[model samples]
Target: MTTQNLLVELFVEELPPKALQKLGNAFANVLFDQLKVRGLTAADSVVTFFASPRRLAAHVTNVLERAADKDVLVKLMPVAVAIKDGKPTDALRKKLANEGRAHLADLWPNAVDGPDSLVVQSDGKADAVYLRGIAIGGTLQVGLEFALNEAIAKLPIPKVMSYQLETDCELPGWTSVNFVRPAHGLVALHGSTVVAVKALGLTAGNSTQGHRFEAVVSPVVLQDADSYAATLRKDGAVIASFAERKAEIARQLAAAAAKVGNGARPIEDEALLDEVTALVERPNVVICQFEEQFLGVPQECLILTMKANQKYFPLLDAAGKLTNKFLVVSNISPEDTIFVTGGNERVVRPRLADAKFFFDQDRKKTLASRVEGLGKVVYHNKLGTQGERVERVRAIAKAIASQLGDAQLVQDADLAAQLAKTDLVTDMVGEFPELQGIMGGYYALNDGLGETVANAIEDHYKPRFAGDALPRNTAGVVVALADKLETLVGMFGIGNLPTGDRDPFALRRHALGVIRMLVEKDLPLDLNALLAGAVPAFGDKITDASAQLADFIYDRLAGSLREQGYSAQEVDAVLALRPQRLALVEKQLAAVRAFAALPESPALAAANKRVGNILKKAEVEGPVDAHVNPELLQEKAEQDLFAALQRFVPEANAQFDAGDYTASLQTLAVLRAPVDAFFDDVMVNAEQLDVRMNRLGLLKMLHNAMNRVADLSRLAV
Candidate 1:
């Protein structure tokens, strides 16, 4: 086996910064998958990736030396059937006769072969000859290129523009392969040598740039890929890794802040650091301070302006208050200057001043007064307006909250919901869309709304993504559930439900958010019952969508519980009980498992199985109200069994009332001994008509008692 090192580089014109990380990740995974799929297994390996605004790189160490030479007996379905008894069929005969091969039996007769062996396949299974024809040997290079190109075609990108039209390019640049952004050239190398890349509309070359502003125009020579990266850094670029860049930014921010009297503390924003890292080759950090007057503006507005507009990092005091100073990380070297510090401050000052104006203007009106403005703002085209959506949410929340025992919070949540969307009309939120909910809470509080109302405004949007924080208070939980339920019911009603991978409305997300609230919050709300409550709120607006809405919510519950390690079948079994309370379902599941594990479980199930089989066959007439005549109960064991049934019934009901299914199951277990004794001592189908009917009635009672915890027939343990 000969192992050859390979490198593929795409040195492109400014690619979209966002696409850099995704594209690099996609390439490594796809390439690794494609190569390994060819039956070549790596002994051990590690893969690391690098990307910047204009470049993407991947390095793999100790990969498979070469693809294993694949050869196996290729099986075909019914290989002999193809030959039709000992001879080929007419079509097969003609082909074989043309080749002068005669019947395959003639070459080595099946009836008269020396070793008494012939390969015959059943009609349902494969045969060797046919499978052999399609088994092309697994070769590394040809297959790798094909796999790489297929994946590259599917990579997601934005702002694609292309040139260099090729007549036969798989996707010609002008109409075919558009880069995430425009491309200048490509460089793919194996160790120190250039490999094929233009088939991908990329040139395989030894040359690449160090930095757009710093390096010379002539192509920089590289002895090896690793040296190429080292040279680029020496020439002025910090292109090692994303993690390295992020760490460097943090290091500089901390050092610079320490020089100040109170020093600086890093605010956590790995995402922000990542984006700035892409825009530069080498990183340099500068600290600047805004006027103290700017702190009067909402901290979110300050954050939005710095992170979004200027790509600057905001500083915070140890108390978590926003300080006037912010950090601006530049990609250029210090000598390049490039107006790096001054230019950033120029952009931030105007944004800061605009925010201050909105803050002052919003305080002029109370939040209650602004609730009327939501009517003018459309929430959905068919749904009337934001105010209308809030009306529906308020009704739904109040109804759900009343059941959950948070009636007081419900009222406050309703008030919060009433005014939640009004802030979208605010100048602050209008200019900074991400600030919608956050600013609403701020403005509502400033307008003299109570803490509960302000919190509900913000909490309603809690858990913006999976694993994100849920609402911290009961009022927040109430409003959040109401808001998501409204969205889900509305979307399904409109026939705009998520299908396949498309969920433009993010219905699944909303359902997940709702599920998390009910379960983790222990809201004492059953999803099914809560869903039923929400239906009246949707009113005639969404009658047909009700079943679809319920199913979607249950599916989300299945996913959420499955993540917690419950199997789909177990969840299905518990849900089959039609639990109206989530807490009850959880309790029942715990009880059932404890009961199911008992030694008595299989035996009771056996008795119930016998009862079900007999009841099914006899078609026992008219709920046989046969009273056992003790004189007719000629068998002593029969009399003994009656005594046991009398004892079991009362305690069973008591256990169920106490919600002690484990004890209920234990109570049922008591009947097993009597059932076994009666079956052993006497035949149930006695000769006397009244005696047989009485016996069957007794068995029927046992079956009814066992069905209470779960369908025991399902437990055929």
Candidate 2:
């Protein structure tokens, strides 16, 4: 069969900007997959998708006009049941009738193994009667209709809208149509031929409208499948591809930024770019500006208002300071350009003014003044108000600070923690919740709080996401840790742990934040101790779930370590010890990796596992002592092992103390040979009770020495 390119387009009202890319991709992919499943796509078939505010379309290459016929096998029934005396039984004839092969009922007795024949074959368990037949090919019209319907049904529309078709008004009764948007037209072409298909009450055609106002023609007519994009662009005044349109917009934005001079550039926001791309069919970047006096507001406040409220890209100078200028991705281009730029500037003035007003109104009240309002705002019903949460955070912050720094640091941490959530009550934050912690810092400075305290208040929410920077100062670190810990402990204590993908509390993120601070900051705090200490702050409001919370944190750490390119074996070995000082985990992992590479690792690791198992069993019988009695070193292998441990363990301990973990593990490698000999020649469970205890003690000492850096047995294959 001959193959040709195919094109399909759905013309509709503007789609949701955030969901346009997904809808377009889903439409094209599902259509291509359905066609391939029906054998209408060639081996080399490929699909290209296009999406814009008003349309979603796909182009497929190497699609066949008709699928090729193929042989099919139909299993009837057991052979004995299908035939009687070499003649077809009634059951066999009935089965063939159901298969639409009733004419073969009489010919089956004389049938041979051919395209349309019946034969007896074993279907794994038993001999069965099979019908071999040739299936007819499907025409492009039929295949395209099915594929189109399937694609429509599968589009990832965020919400569907229901409306009455114009035709429905003329009928006896009204009929309603549901879709992401009201459908205006449908286009389906196989090569130059229009495929008969219908969707959303519209029949397939060769014509589609474009650029509601700028199109050279009212309806751009595509001549063939291969020329769809070019024809649309030439006559319709629209770019047909989402990616191409987005690239063009980026180029224009850059060019516009360059024209502004002073090393100006548009702030990079991919999500904003994508949303803008989805809002316009033809993009023209225009530079616009607001009054310079608006710069008195925090640049963050101004920048956010421009981007979030206006969907404009704020221009930043070489120093990353916001300039008065911004760029707008307009849907149309005018030759004069002045009206377009002036109109955008006029439109954005009120938005900037609102931000300035909120900022000015907010700075009137010091952050300390807002602290009382937090008591009225409910944080969580079970956790009481934000005021109560703040008090808990202050307690945790003071405790963490006392361990990490001097009294001044502690005071700063307490103050920062107290003020961190106060922004939630401000006018600016009430207007834009994303500016919560950010506004607090500004207000802190406005109150004449020292830069250190202001910085701490601002950065207490640092590292809010993955790869986000940690707190910039020690006080910030203390407060951030305390804030995150309070959330985690309170949520977990309330039996509100993250289950599967339903972490409404963002407990996973909070847990990861805690892990990042502890591990990356190399804080000297013990993980378990931190959790236990935070529990008292909750008083009767929570249970002591510190044990469960510790496991959660360690689990997060293990997953993070694996994602960072460490082997599962390496992570398991290091984390198995439940090392309290998370700062030492990285070093322990590195030491484990180094030890695993040694030639003696496999043997030593196996011996260590064996020793662990023996000691575990011995513990059930009584207690296993680490003190090895020289009198009980009767076996030559045991004596040699003890001598090896005596000779090399001290050096390993010293290296471990000095934080030279790799050296420590390497120094212990000397015991591998003696360890292997002891296991091979000595029986851990001796017939003599005293002798058995001594052997257990000897193994205990060896086990302790081997696992100081990591549980070496976990490295075993």
Candidate 3:
């Protein structure tokens, strides 16, 4: 029950702040799980994980003394170590020499002098067997560096390097994992003892130094982890929690900005805040003023310039108009305000001026005129030009627009998709790649394009992350789906499917984007047919990769549906037909979900639980031709179910044909009561082969009705 506080510090040559943060967190998580699995428990364990440019550290407190007591331990020895009849061999004789316990080796002391260290000696026979009474060490430290390396490699840390030595590499990006990022170094410790931790070009050690600016060479010391962190804060001045650092920055910024002009608005940029927090240790908020002339530039362009180039937050007045002031988060203390403020202001001025020039340049030429120039710009070496992609998108848009049944949405698809990539060629987008879609939409709107076209330009890149927002406009959905689908189809056709997590073209994302559009937008999209046509229209350029490409998209469908909380079985059932129609697949998936939630539970699906009896027997009897012969319907349950089918079929068929799948499913749910009663009250095997086959035929008819909606039997209610 004895408790311990543990600290591990890894000092490297300036780790990127993001990587440091990830490493810190990964170490904390890996150690927590590792201890738990080993039955290490404590009253409490609080771990503070933090990182700086040069160090990664975790401070763990109230940890159990050691891993829980082990019930068993077995050590494997080579056949050369075991003599005939399971006696200790001469090798054991020599090993006993060190311990001064060689009673059994007295007869063979001279025979063990050979230095072969053989896995199996030249005995006439050799055997591998478990030693009955092998015993070993009492406890282990569970090298912290080993655990940290594993977890860090899994984190989304970029700029991983590759050391030339094979043994030095902790991870194998060159050998083929998911990504290309390389690992640097790891520092593992148990309490305060150093441990080895090398895997993919990384080596583990005990010593870690502090930040270069303040606690430069005061080797961060800890009797255990808790005390180690206290030393860091006291000496290094590191704000370990990025969120904590960010909040501190915000509070200071608000107070500073209020001093300039009370009741002013604070520009929120959660992303920019995080990035800025990474670059600093102690933060000071600075509010600086710029000339009013810069306000004449497009606010978005100016904002992007300020945030991206200079890492400054814009200030706004009560009316939401851009103010002359900007708030800068400084890394140094208040005494260094003059130096930091001047430096940031100097950097931002040129960016705003460049944006002003670009805005003026873009005003002279419309995005509409530039749309044709996209043809000359290369989209891909194999896929021809960006202009050609626009053409494919046009074809895709036309196809989708016909389904939309709107003239405006249809015509805007061509213009929107064409202009969607035009921003990729813009000076603004070139300066800030993240603004590609935003800038295009702005330009299209300024050039007098319709709202649909402008929105389509933006939404084509919507839902960029998991569970993010998606395009709401119909034209936007078409262009967005087309853009992603074309990339997926093209890469898939090139036999470049994502395997073992390696997707150079982000095919996974492209497919997920398509899934979101089809499901959320409620677009009736046949993904396979759509993607198949997408690559071929580029002049039969992607012939062999079509099948591979379809599979890639389907794999993404499984991922996206799972992300939405759909079970694997339901996904498989809907995808059973390789459903070209995403709407159809999702409809079936939803139907299965509903069936699962029913009160009677399985309803007809309960029959599947006895598949060995019902399905096996029915398949042997073959398909039930539901052409009612009336005389076959002798039982009351049977007659009622048959009549129910008759009543439900016309409506179900009409609903199914009209694409009212949910209504059709509700119509099928009517059979559940009669189905349960029939199974309970009547026996299908009636001591006559004709009767049994006839009943089987009836059951098959009901099953067929369920299939038209979705394979309800797949639902495990």
- Most accurate candidate by lDDT: 2
Q: Pick the candidate with the highest TM-score.
A: 2
Question: Model 2 residue 187 lDDT?
Answer: 96
How does residue 490 of candidate 2 score in lDDT?
97
User: For residues 604-705, could you state the per-residue lDDT of candidate 1 as single tens digits?
Assistant: 777777877876665645564425555666677778877776788779878987889778877777777777888789888788888888777777766667
Give the Å error, residue 577, model 2.
Answer: 1.3
The 10-residue segment of model 1 with minimum total lDDT is 128-137
| Per-residue lDDT over 210-313 for candidate 2, one digit per residue giving the tens place of the 0 to 100 score | 79888999789999999988888899989989999999999999999999999999999999999999999999998889899999999999988888988999
Which ranges in model 3 have alpha carbons more than 4 Å from their true place? 1-4, 11-13, 27-46, 62-243, 257-267, 316-322, 334-336, 524-536, 544-555, 569-591, 597-603, 606-641, 651-700
lDDT of 2: 0.91
After TM-score superposition, the amount by which residue 235's alpha carbon in candidate 3 deviates from its true location, in angstroms, is 5.2
lDDT of 3 by residue, 292-318 (tens): 899988687777778777778888777
lDDT of each: 0.70, 0.91, 0.67
Q: What would the TM-score be for candidate 3 when compared with the true structure?
A: 0.75
Per-prediction CA RMSD (Å): 5.5, 1.8, 7.7
Q: Where is model 1 more than 4 Å wrong at Cα?
A: 37-46, 62-148, 158-160, 165-177, 215-218, 225-231, 246-264, 335-339, 401-411, 468-472, 492-496, 524-529, 544-548, 602-656, 659-717
